[model samples]
Target: MKLIYVFFFFCIINQTYGQQKELELIHNCQGRLSGFATVKVIDKRDSSGKQMIGIVQKGALNKPVKVVFNGELTDSLAAFFIDQSANSNPLPLVLILNELFISEAIDNMTEIGRFRLSLRLFIGKQSDQYSEIVAIDSLYTVKGLDVTKKLLRSISEQFCKISQLAAEKQPILDTDAEKYTFKQLHYLDSLEKMKLPMYQTDHPSVGLYKNYKEFKQNTPGVTAELSIEERKNGFRVYIWDEKRKNKTKLPSTGLYAVSDGTTLLRATPLGFFKILKKGGDFYYWRPQVNKSHHSLVPAAYMYGALGGLVYGLIEAASAGNNKWLLQKINYRKGSAAPVSWTTAKEN
Candidate 1:
């Protein structure tokens, strides 16, 4: 019994030692945020399905620990900005944190951290929102022996930098923000709805859609000879170069979706998805499975419907004010249907 007890004790110690540690984000702002008196942050990351703000390596085993905000991310962010905007002045700001993800990897014994943060800055409070002044969707990478610490420091710096950029937006700040009445807001909303291009289902335009706006407009930016090439992992869009008499792989950075008049494939953060069905205010899509590619990356990366900025725009356009509410694009795994879109949350 004593032997068993000792073994159990040792096991407990090992488990405790190996357990991943969580780090709280500490904001170290060098300067104050000018022009904004108060700050409010709206947490919109629930839709992305990625709750972990960052991951850090801890202990001798270098176990990957999930880094989280001490309290709510929104609260932390708001506090960070409010602390920076201590003596701030005229406008109240609303920061809608769309996505915040940090990933860590060890390359050649050097720790590397990658951060992708997406946020939109509104001129007023959440309920009494004035107008979106700035949108920042950016990716940052840092490499060091203590990459996690460096990454955190970088994030803190970014908080200050973002605030400075917001301060420099003189066009909006100089105008009468209070004069932005509901009638003007309605007019703007109506104008956006009018900008939503009609999707002609009968004869949908064929080719590469640079953005959702292009797709809605039914005018593909790239009408070149393009095809979906099956890759070792999944599928990629390739455009045939008539001059070269060869096909060039189209980079997925700016491309939104590609249609062949018969099938519509939407681009998510992960890969392209074959849109299976379109229903009321929602479009269903599943990952394009390659039978030959047995080893596929986990579907977690492909969870979000659209990328950062695009998703934000889509959400705004799909609100009740807009005539088009085709908000969600579902993506599901294993099932006959497409995988669910991470951004398919109800408003």
Candidate 2:
């Protein structure tokens, strides 16, 4: 059929010219920005030193391509913002790069790509004395063979949106913002770190980790009567009472996540999902996001007991105070190292 020929032609075009082995995060802005006085970028991600953001796969026959910045990530992003700010203003700003990920895959004869970006914006008179003005957690999706073109356009849009966000929130920076210098912030962070319960990896307590920090430190916040039940089609989480010998069904309302020593399960309104992959600073959730109930049947066992949930997986990141919650993660099919959970859903 003509449609089959057209699909193969586009696939070949995408393989030959549309998707490159490596993609850069360059922003071709329409005009230079005049919002911030100075733009500084800090690499604060767990994988800050790594330049590779993610991998892209167009088809089964095509080899997965590694997507990295054209140069060093921090330098590249700083230059990107600075280039946008040709004519500066008066607000000194620092942009902390928390997460940057890009992934592409072919599903149902369509090539789907995702860009997951997270940044924390700070502003003040001095770099060290800046206060966080806004946190940008963004997800973008592009379909078809022109993956590179659409991704670049999305990056430009994100850049402009970030500039607009900073300008709009400038009033907060000028008024009630709590400023922290590098020294003060470091001291505070150090104090908080000292307070973490001493962890012995060999002798980790068994139970559900309330967040990623607890799992990383080998400490489970809730250690009482935790058990996972495998049902006919799915599973159920329960807490056993020692005194009464009764099992109470644990609700997923306030529950964020839980880990059974090795595998980390992302808790959701639907059920639990195994976070089996990680790219850059995040963990990848299986089965993608927002798929119907049929999608779960194929990976139901892999999900570790997701009943009939419509929504797929969750992305979790560490927030201070030993807490971790939803955050975007890059998805790749394969077993990954243990630690935390993440997903590629828009938040």
Which ten-residue region of model 1 has the weakest summed lDDT? 330-339
**Tens digit per residue, CA lDDT, model 2, 1-347:** 44554454345435643344555555555554556656777765544325556556533233344555666666656655553344565667777665666666556545577877777777766444767778776678999744755765576577766766676675354556567764554333334334443222323455676655665565678876567765542356777787847988877555545644554555656566554333322353333232122323433343334421211331111111112223333121111221222333222
Q: Which stretches of candidate 1 lie over 4 Å from their true place?
A: 1-23, 33-36, 48-50, 55-65, 83-87, 106-110, 125-129, 164-204, 210-218, 224-256, 266-347
Work out the TM-score per prediction: 0.54, 0.54
Residue pairs with backbone atoms closer than 3 Å in model 2 (clashes): 315-327, 315-343, 329-343
Candidate 1 lDDT tens digits, 241-292 = 7774898876766677787676666676667655544321225333321121
Instruction: Evaluate model 2: give its lDDT.
Output: 0.52
RMSD of each: 13.4, 11.6
lDDT of each: 0.54, 0.52
- Clashing residue pairs in candidate 1 are 285-338, 286-338, 286-339, 331-339, 331-340, 331-341, 332-338, 332-339, 332-340
